[model samples]
Target: MACYTKVEKETCIACGTCGAIAPEVFEYDDSGFSQSVLDNNKGVQAVPEEVAEDVEEAYEGCPSGSIKLNDTPFKPKTPVSS
Candidate 1:
C-alpha cells in the first residue's frame, strides 16, 4: 500500500527530531524548519515502501506532533452524471 506524509509548517518547531530520525526522507529547509524531502519538498509526498518505517519514526518523533501520514492513496471523488 502507498503512504502519504506531510508536515504542518505552522506547527513545526524546527526541532530537527524528524530529520535526525529519518534523514533519508526528512530534512531541514532553508528556513531551518523540518520538511519532507519528497515531492520536490512540497511539504506533502508519497513515502516509498523502503522508507515507510523511517517516515513513521519521524511522525512519531516529531515533538510538536506536526507530522501527518495518510496510509492510503488519495482518490478524488467522481461526480455523478446529471
Candidate 2:
C-alpha cells in the first residue's frame, strides 16, 4: 500500500513543523513554505507505506491544517479550502 501527503501552501503558516516531524517526506521550499521533499514545490508525493505513521504525525502536528494525507495512491486534486 502506498501512502501520500500534500501540504496546502496557501494555508500553510510556513512554521516548518512538517519538515521537522518528517524530514524524509517534507521540507521547506525556497519560499519558506513546507513542500513534499519529492515534489520540491507546491505538489504532492507518494510516500512509502512504512513511513505512513510519521507522515500522519506531521499532518497532525500541522497547526495550520495544511498537511493532507490519503491512503489511496491517486488522490483527487481538490481545491484548497479557504
Candidate 3:
C-alpha cells in the first residue's frame, strides 16, 4: 500500500523534530514551521518505500503530533450499480 505524509500547519509548533528525524522528507518552512518537502512544494508528500520507516519515526517523534501517514488514496468514488 502507498502512503503519504503531512503536517498540520495549524497545530505545528516549529520544533524541528520532524526535520531532525527525517530531513529528506521534512524541512523548515520560510516561517520556521515544519513542512513536507515533496510533490513540488506541496506539503503532502508520498512516503517512499525505503523511507517509510523514517517517516514513521518522524511521525512518532513529532512533539505537536502534527505529522501523519495517510495510507488511503484520495479519489472520488463512483456510484455502485445495483
Clashing residue pairs in candidate 2 are none
TM-score of each: 0.77, 0.76, 0.77
Query: How well does model 2 score by local distance difference test?
Result: 0.77
Error of 3 at 41 (Å): 6.5
lDDT of 3 by residue, 14-55 (tens): 888888888888897888778778752343456778878888
For every candidate in turn, the CA RMSD to the true structure comes to 5.5, 4.0, 6.2
Q: Using alpha carbons, what is the TM-score of model 3?
A: 0.77
Write one digit per residue (lDDT tens) for candidate 2, span 1-82. Answer: 6666777889999887888878888887778888887655433467877777888899888999998777654445688899
Q: What is the per-residue lDDT of model 1 for residues 13-80, given as tens digits with 9 covering 90 to 100?
A: 99888888888888778887777778645444578789889888889888899887887543433789
User: What's the lDDT for residue 16 in model 1?
Assistant: 82
Question: How many residue pairs in model 1 have overlapping backbones?
Answer: 0
Off by over 4 Å in 2: 41-45, 74-82
